[model samples]
Target: MSKKNEVSFFDGKGLRNDGRRLDELRPIELEVGVLDNASGSALIRQGGNRILVGVFGPREIHPKHLALPNRATLRCRYHMAPFSVEDRKHPAPSRRETEISKVIREALEPVVFTEYYPRTTIDVYIEVLEANGGTRCSGITAASLALADAGVPMRDLVVACASGKVGGKIVLDLNDFEDKYGEADMPVAILPHLDRVLLLQMDGNLTPKEFHEALDLAIEGSKRIYEMQKKALRDSYPIPDEPQEEEVVEVEK
Candidate 1:
């Protein structure tokens, strides 16, 4: 391993900076319908990364030119708050944000039943209130939950997660530090039930073997996130009480 990859990101016992095992993911907390104003909303926290997503529409599309005649259009906007990071970022949307927004939309479009709502639009907004790393993946995860909460028909929920090579070891769910210095980082979104890759992106250097290892790790991580998404949706609307049976009145009859 070169000096860059030799940093003690992981100790001899195979523990990361935050004491996570090589294949372990950071803790995650998710909730749905967090915003009353939006049709549906979700908030998710993974380690220091926090993302909020809102879904609106299945309504007529404005500016008629933007609507698709055969299917509903899906639009997504991803933004980072000015105070989300250590250095205050400008509130204006940056080029990076725009690209992320596009990818997020594509990641979700596959599962949504767009054909059911022709000439309409479904808008998804993702706000990164705080970011430590893996914000994009977490944002996509939250967006899918928000869409389901809104009652949008879908084939499956999308789940996303990232893995990277740090300290010459493949690790699941890189944090900010790992992302900045890791040898390689790969983020992926998947349709867990079908085991299909919806989105895949990578940066940095990795051997073919390492790349496959990272992909496998990311896929496993996504499955865990998929379960969490299901729990959040179920918790949002608990089962109602069963109706009580009326008493018989044999004597009166």
Candidate 2:
């Protein structure tokens, strides 16, 4: 995009654009309960990019054909702001966004205990206020956290992260510039407790072995993110394991 864009990951001393090591993510900041009306919501800011997500329903299925008697349905919508990019993105769901939304829904379906609510629906809406790169991963990350905040039952929370090849080396969490010039990208979603992947996608080019290595790097990064998620949720809602208030005795005649 920019002529000043430099190939990251092997910059002689091996430092990335934001001074992170190859396997480090660009610092992520997450906030829940940001939206007033949504049933569940969260916002994620990874470096300069900003993504806000709102999850509604487990309520009902629309259009009728989309409904299933056996299990609930999961729906996702991802969009970018007009000024989110340097080139200015349109306020519509591009073809890429459509495909990504489907994948994201599939990713969370496994983590969500959908069978608990049969013949229902869950809607996850993600809006990217800024796009420096890796918005899809950020959206997924924010959506998962929002779902939990909404009091949805789930087997485990999903943490999404990405890794890619830059200057012939697998770099964890590609920033804006590296993604444009880098060789390949692999984004993944991990179930924290099980430590297993739920969503995986790769683009561009890489050897099969390199792909595996990249995946490992992404998983490592996701775990770090998972820790952050847990801390954030706890900080927002802290409860004592045991009751703190003393019970009042009642004297009746």
Candidate 3:
């Protein structure tokens, strides 16, 4: 990685520090409903990065006191694959992952209709198959898709994106180099339907006006991603043909 903050690295002849243009996004690929065992599942590919998300039942609750009297419990787990990073990751959950999981759970709770399944709990699992710069935001995006695919009622689709300043230029959807050396990074989860924000995190430094500009850029990037999520879901599950019944006739001689 470069120094703490430098945009000179992005001077790759009109391309980003990572060789991508300012308006360009990493190539994205998606598949939904991949795990039949789970209520809903999705796999997302954004360039070399991959993430899988699983949604499991509003089933009976455990550790009962945590359960709310009026609503079901929402549980979220975010973990990295052992081989997700350049170095093998430890099997046990890291403090960073745990903190991310906690924050994601909070961001998702308001969108989920937990009240409908009182005394129950729904598990949202995110596994990072590969790592890029924006894994957490990717996890948020995948988890929301999995929940929606599972037929869970939600108020709106949550889309997440990260923005940062590189070489004195504010950019949307940062990549590895930009994030590692960024002056400021703002990651956010936005409700595309309602034009609202749920989760927002900032790292590094920026002026208040610059922060507002970064926030707006993040929201704009998220909206575009939200559209892709909707398209992925629609493509994954086509309308099933009507069931066919076997015709019965007299036994053959």
Which candidate number has the best lDDT?
1
**Candidates ranked, most accurate by TM-score first:** 1, 3, 2
> Any idea what lDDT model 3 has?
0.85
Who is ahead in lDDT, 1 or 2? 1
lDDT for each residue of candidate 1 in 108-131, tens digit (9 for 90 to 100) = 999999999999999999999999
lDDT score, candidate 3, position 11? 64
lDDT of each: 0.93, 0.85, 0.85
Deviation of model 1 at 156, angstroms: 0.2
**Model 3 lDDT tens row, 12-71:** 476785677765667877788999899998998876779999999888778887788888
Ranking 1 against 3 by TM-score, winner: 1
> In model 3, which runs have C-alpha deviations exceeding 4 angstroms?
1-7, 240-253
Could you tell me the lDDT of residue 130 within candidate 3? 90
Tens digit of per-residue lDDT, candidate 2, span 1-253: 4642543345557678678888888989999878888988999999878999999978888887888888888889888888888887777789988998888888898888888777888899999899988988888889998999988898878899999998788899888888877888888888978877888888789898998899888998998998888777766686754334322222221
TM-score of each: 0.92, 0.88, 0.90
